[model samples]
Target: MKKSRLILSLLLAFASTLASAQSENPPPVKEDFKPSVLNQPGKEYPQVNSQGYVRFRIEAPDAQKVHVSLGLGGRGGTALTKGADGIWEGTTEGPLDEGFHYYHLNVDGGTFNDPGTLNFYGSVRWESGIEIPAADQDIYALKDVPHGKVEQILFPSKSTQTSRRAFVYTPPGYGKDRSKKYPVLYLQHGWGEDETAWSNQGHANLIMDNLIAAGKTQPFLIVMTYGMTNEVKFGQLSSFDITPFQTVLLDELIPYVDANYLTQADPAHRAMAGLSMGGMETRTITLANPGVFSYVGLLSGGSISMEDLEKSPDFKKNVKLLFVSYGSRELDNPRRGPWGDPKENTAAVTAAGLKTHFYVSPNTAHEFQSWRRSLYVMAPMLFK
Candidate 1:
């Protein structure tokens, strides 16, 4: 009996130890971490269409307050309610019109991104963003229309051995009609942005896509490249050093694109366009290599001088169109660089006998909206 009791006690002790070990080492968690969500299954924001308030709902259990800031020229309003389930709701008076507006959310002044929507940052930071398909009439403001293709391709830069990536957009029917070559527009992005700036922030692709579909604009290939030569950033350095960038485009980017795509490589079929520093680069390229690009569109940029025109002996005979554009609101802001002052350069280019189109957008500022409008107006002028 004693032996049997001792055996039973030993078994009980072993069982207790095993139970404790198993309790300490539990199974791994199954659900991985994910971004916070406002609307779960069966929960959603009110169905507001393209002309109503901009609505946002977020679930932040501990957040005491939530608010959104309206971008461009006005202050933002506060949210309407906080639900029992830790969800907060807000609305604004405008679904801003057909132009691009950037915004952000301030959770008691601590910033947070919208969980439900695709975010877009401008030529600068991504933290600043706005909601699209948010009560707006503009189709390009995030409608689900058939879109054009913007490809990111790397090409050799004579300025440096490290390959540079450029953004290219082929119009809707670029592949379908193989026999007919399309006119090419070599576009450049401003400093601090890659080739994606024109398409994403500037909405160049959508503008071209819409224009081509409507037959309002000629179908052309847009080749947007990095504007900096060997410099890491474009505007961080002065425009005087951009000659090497011009060389890279001329010696490498232009030739590679022409060879790979179905493009009419002739000067008459070639053009250049850019914003800010990009605009400056465009002017430099056309002036240095006269007869290379027939048409030039300068949007919110281009720091050309009378001397530049005089230096280019063939500036008059080779060039076809010189379109210089700037926002009326940007004239006061020196941050727009040298292109804001178009009078002297305009007179110089006109005196050189090139057809000059000086365009000014009243009340528009040195922002992407101004550039987008500039592109829309200037695209129709190409290959005509």
Candidate 2:
């Protein structure tokens, strides 16, 4: 009886100590939420808390079912409960990854956008977008700096037989020196996104503006065009052909850009980069035309292999930089993509006497935030 009493006393003391520890390090309390920056003027329903939980409100009284298509789970997973006031509202079960996310409302079996937030083009259509403030958002934050102009140019593409549009970003001192020819980076958007993505979604212009002001990156020109990815559905990726878009970019767009803009007009100063499917396009086109681009970047897209270097000797010889980056969450996933291990592949490329860099974004997935961070890390290394 004495021994049993002693054991019971020890157990109770242990429980008390554990409770004290928990009280000292209590679980995070839900922070007060504010209207998301992406919300429409005076809209207060689509809000985000400091913990990254998204709260959505919809005034659909007659809707039988309503759900949000974003958050930890997939589409139609976040079921909104109808309140007594006839307003359908819900909060994400957990925190979302930092950056922008596109979501839509499914009400009464019909897909619709949340009227509270602004729309962004994704999945080949306009969907409501929200911004979850990031810890390291200062890198892309709008500052009092010399901003560059993102000019839209429509260049004729005879292969497609239409006037294809492209957005160009000329650095701050571009017009000041008429004779100065800036190096060009032919940047491409991911699948389902068009030319405006780099500007609107990724804030490529603002990124460059801040980088230039801080002297963190080289002032250069950036060109973004539609990668013709909308025609290819997600399941039918294998059926996508590169010949047409390659022809349009190489034969038409390059010539037009050189003729119109004060570009360096040499292979040593030109580069190509893309995100996701756009990265796949960059790899194909860069391999096919070795002399066109000296630097290459792939953001959440893919990586270059030893086999690739063996086949394209000229690219291996002349390429100035081969940069590959993916979000850390993607690398931690079970799906390591088609190239096997991107990190190991990049290490192999580095071992083969070529300048190579592999960057993994912290706490992000395959989103614009990853691509934006990739551009920031890779831009300073270009044309040097």
Best candidate, lDDT-wise?
A: 2
In candidate 1 the C-alpha lDDT for residue 3 amounts to 31
CA error at residue 295 for candidate 2, angstroms? 0.5
How high is the lDDT of residue 191 in model 2? 67
Q: Enumerate residue pairs that collide in model 1.
A: 50-135, 103-129
On residues 207-313, what C-alpha lDDT tens digit does candidate 1 reach at each position? 88787767788788999886656555323332236557777888898899988899998999999888766776677668778989888888876545567667887
User: Any idea what lDDT model 1 has?
Assistant: 0.63
Best by TM-score: 2
> What TM-score should be assigned to candidate 1?
0.68
Could you tell me every candidate's TM-score relative to the true structure? Answer: 0.68, 0.90
Write model 2 residue lDDT over 1-384, tens digit each, in one string. Answer: 343233223322221210011112323539699999999999997999988878989999988999888756333346799999999988876777788777799988898999999888776778888888998788789888888899999999888778988999998878787798999999988766788888888989998999899998889999999887336664544456777788888999999999999899999999999987678779878977888999999887778889888888888888999999988877766667566688988899899988998999888777888888999899999999
> What overall lDDT, based on C-alpha atoms, would model 2 receive against the true structure?
0.81
Off by over 4 Å in 1: 1-98, 103-112, 121-124, 131-148, 156-159, 228-244, 303-305, 332-340, 343-348
